[model samples]
Target: TQGDSGIQRKGIILGKELARSLGAYTGDLLAMMSPSVRMTPLGIIPKIKMVEVVGIFESKMYEYDSNLAFISLSSAQSLFGMKNRVSGIEIKVDDIDAAGHIAVVIQKKLGAPYFARGWMQMNKNLFSALKLEKITMFIILILIILVAAFNIISTLFMVVMDKAKDIAILKSMGATRASIMKIFSMQGLIIGVCGTALGCLAGFTIVPNLNKIVGFIEQLFDIEAFPSDVYYLDELPSQIQYFDSFLIIVFSILICFLASLYPAWRASRLDPVEGLRYE
Candidate 1:
């Protein structure tokens, strides 16, 4: 409707990017060829048909936008010389996670010569690569948090030494060793908890807007960070997994707890006499 007044019986709708690449627009004629061949006077030749461009569409994925096209079912069948037969039909399911199962069911029902493939199967490699990237990023994050935990450990040890005289005075005042240990352990754990909370706050606030942030930087610098053609994407998209975030936070907190242990134990073991004598 946006292009030609109407889609004629033999008209086609080209993808936006595809039309741009072909320098074609509304009401333009395009020659479509099919692998099906016919015996000609000279030799066998591929079948070809000239069809009017009726409209254009976009799917966000550069791979689809740059290569996909749409035509009438009858027109496609005629082009392939498949008379009354179709290559395939696309079915959309409400739940994407059940796609593979539905595909199997369809395949079983269709029986011989007919098979079904889900979107996941069609794009397996891409998803696998994405999973690997997630894993690598997670590992890197853990390493960074581990380094911070070591810093916390060092800081707590320093606190224990700095407060040695105070511990001696507390012991003389009839304070229990467990209470002293609890004080140092809590100091380290509290530091870790606060840092984790702040990091989560920043990550949640920023990660969702990464696309806009990157776009601004690119515009400011006159640079292209993610080239559309190269990445097969019109723009970058990000999704946050709450479960993964929860796991990371829990692990970081555990690391902090572990880092607090040695220092707390050493503080509890301090000899009040030695501490007072040194003072």
Candidate 2:
């Protein structure tokens, strides 16, 4: 790690094999310079120095691949001439979900000198836009379920028309108007449960291997892999919360129940004399 004042080169950190791969090893001199550019009367001067490699470290991320150099905090601070001052500090919370509350607690604990931010707050704009897009996509996808519910409505309405005489006979036999409603409601519930279950199953089956599926499609279609740069994530991310799944199932059932209303009411209002006479 290089800083403004000078550099700290030799630090025994990484082991032998890694150092050899990086073309660096213990006792090898490494040079580092401060990031600051000073405009003197003569010209812009950059502070620079060299250090002997004592150790090396690696982080799995591509951003840190082959580029990160480790140095002592004291060396960094002195080199930058930032006496007792740091550009920023990183904090990690035990539970990521509680980051917002933790950040607030930290701010309060530390009082006025420092400001704290959570990961979500730091990425608020990006996450907010993603949330909006996801909601819109959900609404659009739900139309598929709604359309399926309409199919239930159409099928039951036909059954009502075909069984009008039976329904009338039931009504005359002391099966109250509400009982007639229950019959059709049960039919609609069956269809809704079947369709929602199938849809949920299909979603789960596809989501787990979505990346592999996309890779195959890209190869077959002769297109590039999905754009990782734009998306920031390497693969599609799907977080399946059981609660969310339950909400979807409940919502689909409601759509189906509501769809049954008009047709069921029509069946309940029919007169036994008129229905049987027509038959």
Candidate 3:
């Protein structure tokens, strides 16, 4: 385990991306300089010291991976001439989900002159952007469901046109108008249910293997489809949330049900006398 300053007497830990960029490895010496100047006999000069690289940390985020470096608290304090003070405190909580609440508590306890901030509050903008992107994608993906609903609507209309005589016969034989409506509605519901099931099946089957699928495509095309340098990620990321999936399925079914309403109503309103006359 390493401390806040990240400096050790033996060496220092550098961010993985920074180390890679510098072509440095363990045991390699890295010179660090402070902007603060020290007085010398000749003139003022920036303070500089060389330290060995002991380890590298991978944070996965490009911003942190490329920029952050760690040194020990004693080394940092000595180098910066800060005797017994720290800029901030880092706290780890048992439940990450309660970080916001905990931060508030800490802030209250610390009171004026000091404030506690959670990672969520610190990175609120980035998370907000991600949330917005997710919502936009959700809206765009919903078009596919709307298209499927349209298909259901057209199919139900065609079925009702074809079965007009049968519907009229059923109505004359004691089936109520509401029952006729339900029959077509159920037909549409069955189509929607089957479609939703197949979609969920395909999603579950493919999402887990999406990385492999991308790799195959890249190999087939002899191209780097997602370059790590450009994307800042070695591989694609995929997450499956059951609640999100359930919401999508429910929304799709609701759209399908709404689409079926007009067609089913039309089917129920067909005059039995006219339908029988044509037959």
Taking all chains together, each candidate's TM-score versus the true structure is 0.91, 0.70, 0.86
The parts of candidate 1 lying over 4 Å away from their true place are 1-7, 42-45
Q: Mind giving the per-residue lDDT tens digits that candidate 3 earns over 1-279?
A: 222234567478887788889998887898888777899999999988788888888877667777888888877877787878887879899999899999999889989999888889998997898899999999887988889888998999899888989988998998988999998898888888888899999999999999999999999999988776677676889989999999999998888888899999999899999778867
Give the poorly placed runs of model 2, Cα more than 4 Å off.
1-35, 38-42, 48-75, 83-85, 141-145, 164-180, 272-279
The whole-model lDDT of each prediction reads 0.89, 0.75, 0.85
lDDT of 1 by residue, 1-279 (tens): 257645579899887888999999888899999999999899999999999999988787789888888888889989989899987889999999999999999999999898899999999999999999988998899899889989988998898888899998999899898998898888888988999999999999988998999999999999999998999886788888899889989999889988998899999989899889967
TM-score of 2: 0.70
Candidate 1's TM-score? 0.91
Q: How many backbone clashes does candidate 2 have?
A: 13
RMSD in order of candidates:
2.2, 6.4, 3.2
Cα error, candidate 2, residue 169 (Å): 6.9
Q: Cα deviation of 52 in candidate 3 (Å)?
A: 0.7
Give the per-residue lDDT of model 2 (tens digit) for 31-147.
567887678999998876566675554443323333455566776666787878887788887999999999999899988878899989998998999899989989986988778
Candidate 2, after superposition: displacement of residue 214 in Å?
2.6
Ranking by TM-score: 1, 3, 2
For model 3, what is the error of residue 257's alpha carbon versus the real structure, in angstroms, after optimal superposition?
2.3
- The ten-residue window of minimal lDDT in model 3 covers 1-10
User: Of the pair 1 and 2, which is ahead by lDDT?
Assistant: 1
